[model samples]
Target: MYQKKLVGVFGDPVDDNPSVVIEQVAFDYMKLPMEYLTIQVKKGDLQAAIEGLRAMNFTGINITMPHKIDVLQYLDYVADDAKIMGAVNTIYVKDGKLYGENTDGKGFMRNLRNGNVPTKGKNVVLLGAGGVARAISVELANAGVKHITVVNVIKEEGERLVELLNSKTSVEATFVFWDHKYSVPDKTDIVVNATPIGFVNKEEKPNIVYESIHPQMVVCDVIPNNMNTLFLEEAKKIGCKTFHGMQMLVNQGAIAFELWTGLEAPVQVMLEALAKVYGD
Candidate 1:
């Protein structure tokens, strides 16, 4: 019998994180000798947390919240994509060395591709300038998006993201200071709410001009637990196709599962597990 491998997600306020559930579900389904854990490492103890994982010979770890950016310094290697995004959400151990990767953006890109949503030369608008937004923007740029507009309530953060995109990639990027009911530009091809506004309250969403959503455009939100957020609902009311965060969550989880175990992830099984947990 193979020795059980230990995997865990480390973060403060870790109670609500779904990674443990989905990852453990995948491991159970595959009958892998692995244990998934939720570790509450306070922000100040992240360095110690990394060292502890190293000492424990853990198979892998998922970093979340305040640790994503800081955990980079402790890892042995970080993928180029995670370096560009300035965050690392997933890490796997190989040759006893830690490797960091950002699956958030790739998850969105994969979900879009899976749904036959094209990003090549498409004009995209992001609804926030947070960590997930950074990851998605880099992936969008690499996928040949023609333009990106980041809208945020904070001018500095939004501008920083736009600057990173414009300088680091060929994608033409701009930042918009979000105040009042921001009108979606007529030419927008895809609109994504990368913010957390809808995570807690399904009825609350980003303050965008819902009437401006065109039926031809694709709409997305990143709030996983509350999959049916008001943002996507409003887009549907406008006759536009929309989807919430379940796909992104499961896709990202699946990616991590593959990287850690070197086996094909049961994507559908993982999706069902998350859906049941969220009552989706």
Candidate 2:
């Protein structure tokens, strides 16, 4: 019998609640001798946790919020996408080298395409200008998205993302104010909720009125805890196509699993895992 390799996600709040999708992928689908674990590490203790992983010969680790960018400094090498996004969501040890990669962008794009949500020549409104948002903007641009409008609570953060996208791709990117009382653009092809508005404990939701969303437009919220967020629920009521953050998590987790194991990811296994955990 092969020795079971160990992989898991690491973050402050994630220790006790590792992603169910990840666990399902490892235990049910991949069928590899691997056990998924979650490690909670506060900002100050991140370095110690990473060191401990290295010492314990962990095959790979997924870095989540509050640690994604901070973990980069300790990595041996970072992939271009992670460096550009200033975030590292996935890390793997191979041939005595630590490699970092950001699959959030690819994962988002995969979910969009899989759902038949148009992107090419579409005007996209991206909420939040943080790490995940940055990656999503880049991917949209690369996928031939016609234009992108970014909105964030902080004006400067949104502007920075716009500048980065403009410098990196020809896609027209702009920043807009997220007015709580205003309506979303009717011409917007897609609206992506990339903020932590619907995250666990952070129950604050986006202010966009669901009735303003048109059937021609698609709404995507990057919160995975619940398959149907208030954002998605409202979009559904408006007859608009919708996507949850679960797809992003699954695609990215699968990509990370492949990177670590060099085997095709058991997508069905991962999907079932996520469904069981999140009640999808």
Candidate 3:
């Protein structure tokens, strides 16, 4: 007995996207006239899907994976941060114009703040130079991080990310070869895994060394499919504060929610919903 407002996530292989459940739970808790879905849009069909969302008066939609970069071409306006990262994960239509923004970095920062992890004047050892790494590194630099050492299997990509972070921001950044062993430098305050290493298969082992993690640092992984990534488990074993992958997933969705409805997102509620789905 209410009006219907449409919102959803767009990506290939989106059938298991947890955003669908968490977002719908928030909408229901707030009693908002909204429904969330996981729309599977193949790479070739991205443009048509975006156009359809706008033409049909959809509120806003979250972009993911292969579409994050391609979807930027269709937006009428892109936020400065999103343009800087060369990716867009959230899109909202307002005044007949579609606007794009990247909430992944901000979402990760919010997760850190919620967990009481400090960023200013800290050293970070980041794994991977992909999209999630780019977003997080940009945000960390903006947050006054002292220095960052990025490790990646691809030397070119890693150097590119370091150059971008060093040239564009105040953070001193460097690239290191990732041998998939315990090579983390001393005095590092944060460690992040932004790669897809752990998502390949259940039998696949973690790329980062468990013994190298110090108890004084914070370890984070961007893979959300598995809540207890081996990296996190290793960090916990060492008594280091660990941030789960789902934290960023839920926080990013909450940021998108705030952008769409202009309402304070119930972050804890969203976290609970995610835990229910992933069985935390």
Model 1 regions more than 4 Å off: 1-3
What are the clash counts of all predictions, listed in order?
A: 0, 1, 0
lDDT values for all models: 0.90, 0.81, 0.86
- TM-score of each model, paired residue for residue: 0.95, 0.87, 0.92
Total clashing pairs in model 2: 1
Residue 237's lDDT within candidate 2 is 83
* lDDT for each residue of candidate 2 in 1-280, tens digit (9 for 90 to 100): 5666788888866433535446545655545777877777789998898887777888988888889999999889998767877889889998777888989998888898888777789999898998889998988888899999998888888899999988878799988877564467888999999998878744566877666779888889888677788778888888888888887888888788888889877776676677677754
For candidate 3, write residues 1-280 as lDDT tens digits: 5558899888866556788877888899999999987888889999999999877779999998888998889999998778878899999888878999998898889889988888999999998999999999999999999999999988899999999998888999999887757477768999998888667564454566567677898888888767787777778889988887787988998899998899988888998888877744
Candidate numbers sorted by lDDT from highest down? 1, 3, 2
Question: Total backbone clashes of model 3?
Answer: 0
Winner by TM-score: 1
Worst 10 residues of 3 by lDDT: 200-209
Better of 1 and 2 by TM-score: 1
